[model samples]
Target: MCGSDLHYYRAENDGTPAESRCIGGHEPAGVVESLGPGVNGARLSVGQRVMVHHYSGCGTCMNCRSGWTQMCTSAPAKVYGKNAHGAHAQYMAVPAACVLPLPDELSFCAGAAIGCGTGTGWGALERLGEVGGLDLVVFGQGPVGLSTTMLATARGARVIAVDPSASRLEQASKFGAADTVNPDSVDPVEAIRELTAGAGAAAAVETSGATVAATAALDALANWGRLCAVGLGGTIAFDVRTFLSRQVTAMTSWSMSSVQQMACADFVARRNLPVDDLFSHHWSLDEAVPAYEEFDKQSAGKAAFVF
Candidate 1:
C-alpha cells in the first residue's frame, strides 16, 4: 500500500506506525467470493470482480450521509492495513458499501492502483479545480505524483515535475511533464519561476512528503496560486505572512472518496490511459517484504504485489 506498510511492519509502536499485526495491503482488486447477509441487498453478487475501497465508514455519520465517507467522524473507521486485516491475503472481507464493480476490460493491478495512488490524484485535482491552461508543478515522481502529472497534462495543463532522481524526472517527462527539475542540483523554486516566466506555477502538488519539498512547493507558487499537499511525510512549518502577502492557498488532500475513486477508474478506462507503463515491477505475496524494501529504496518505477 504505497510502501508505507514496511514502516508499520518494522516498527509496531511508533506513532507513525500502527501496532497491528494484520496482513498488509490496502489497494486490492479481487472477485467477490461471498457476501455477508447484511450486504445481500446491495447488489454485490458472488463471482463478480471488484475493487475494494479499503476504508469503510458508519452509514449514519454525517460525513457518510454527505457522500464524503473518507471524513467519517463517529466511529474509528476501519481501513485496510491500519485498523484491520488488509487484502494482502488471498481473500479480504470488506463491507459491501466499500466495493466498486470493475469493468471486465480493466486489469486487477490497474484497478488496485486506482484504489489508492490514482484516486488520491483525482481527489487533489478536484480540490484544485479548473486546471485547464494552468502551469502545474508536481513535487515528487512517485506513483501518486506521476498520476497527478498525467491527469493534469491530459486536462491541458503545462506540467513541471520536480524530483531528486533523474530517472523519475525522465519518467515524469514521458508522462507529459513539459519540464523537469532536479532539486539536488538546482533551486527548484527558481527553476519553476524561470519555467513559468517569473510567475511560478499556477498550481503545485506536493507529493514528496518531505519537509524540504513542502517548503519548496510553497515557495514556488505564484500569487494566488493553489498548493495541494498529498504526501504522507511529517509536518513542516511555513511562514503565514509569505502566503498571506501572495494570497496563496494551502490545502491538504487525503485519500479520495468512493465516488471520486470510481470516477477516476472510469476516466482511465474511457481514455485508455497508459496504466501499464506505470507498473515496472511485480511480485507475489511471498516476495512482498523484499519488494517493499526495493520500493522503499526508490526503485525507478512503480512496484506491485501480484496475486
Candidate 2:
C-alpha cells in the first residue's frame, strides 16, 4: 500500500457514513476479468494483464483526450480509492480509457508500483530535466524517494539520499545511491554540500512532504539548480529574491499521466530492474489490519496485498 492509502484510512473523509466510505487502493494491477461493451478487444482482452491509470475525468475534456485525465478541466475529476471505488477488493471496474498495458516481464506487484509511486518518481525526474553525470539529492527515503534514487542512478546520476532513518538510508544505498545523509545526526544541507565538494547538488527532489526537509532540499541546491517537489502537504517558505539570485528553478510534480506510466513501465521492463524489491511486505487481504498497523509506523518500504 502507499502513504496515501494510510491518509485516506485515517481521515474522516467528509464525514461520510462508515458504510459509504471510499475504498483505499489506487495502485492497482491485475488481469482483466472482463471488459465492458464498446471496448476494443484488440486493445484489451479478457485475460490481458493491465494497470489502471486511477484517475477518471469527463471524456470530452482536452486533457482527457490527451491522456491526462487527472488534469481534466471540464468537470469534477474522480480519483479511484479516494472519491470512487478503489482496488482494495478482489475486483475493480474502471473506464477502458483508464487502463494501460503492462509489460509481461513485470509482475502485477511491479506494475502496481509503476501505477503510482515509481511513476511519481519518473514524473519528478522528468521535471528536473537531464541528470547524467550530475549530483542529485532526494529527500525522504520513502517508496517514492527510493524509486527516484534508483531511477536517477540508473540514468547515470550520482544520487545523495537524505533521510532521518538509518534503515531507510541503508535501503537507499542498496538502491544505488552513491551517498546517504541523516538529517537527525547532521546538518543535511552542510552534509550535502560537503558530499558535492561544497558546490551542492545540481538538482533536488523532495518526497518526504515535511516542511523542514523541503526547505533543506532547497538550501542544498547549487546555483542555477533545479528543484522538483513531489511530496504533498505543508506550506514551504519561498524567498523570491533568494531564489531569483540563485537562479534556481522550482517545480511541483504530481503523478504521471497514462503515457508516462507506459514509458516508466517500459523502462523498468527493459532494465529488468528489481521493482519488486521495493516491497518489504507482501500481505493477504486477511492480514490487512496488521499490515496497515505496521505500515502506519512510517519506517518501511512499500507494502502490497497479494490476491
Best by lDDT: 2
Against the true structure, what is each candidate's TM-score? 0.93, 0.96
Q: Where does candidate 1 have its weakest 10-residue lDDT segment?
A: 11-20
Candidate 1 regions exceeding 4 Å error are 12-19
lDDT of each: 0.84, 0.91
Residue 72, model 2: Cα distance from true site in angstroms: 0.1
Model 2 spans > 4 angstroms off: 12-16
Candidate with top TM-score is 2
Alpha-carbon shift of residue 161 in model 2 (angstroms): 0.3
lDDT, candidate 1, 1-307, per-residue tens: 5656656655653444333367778889989998887786557888998997878889678787655666789877787877788988878888788889887778988898888888788889989999999999999998888999988898789999999998889889988999999999999999999999999999999887898998899899999999999898647567787677899988998878888888888988888777657888988888876777777677657777777
State how far residue 159 of model 1 sits from its true place (Å).
0.8
Cα lDDT, model 2, residue 209: 92
- Model 1 residue 162 distance off true place after TM-score fit, in angstroms: 0.4
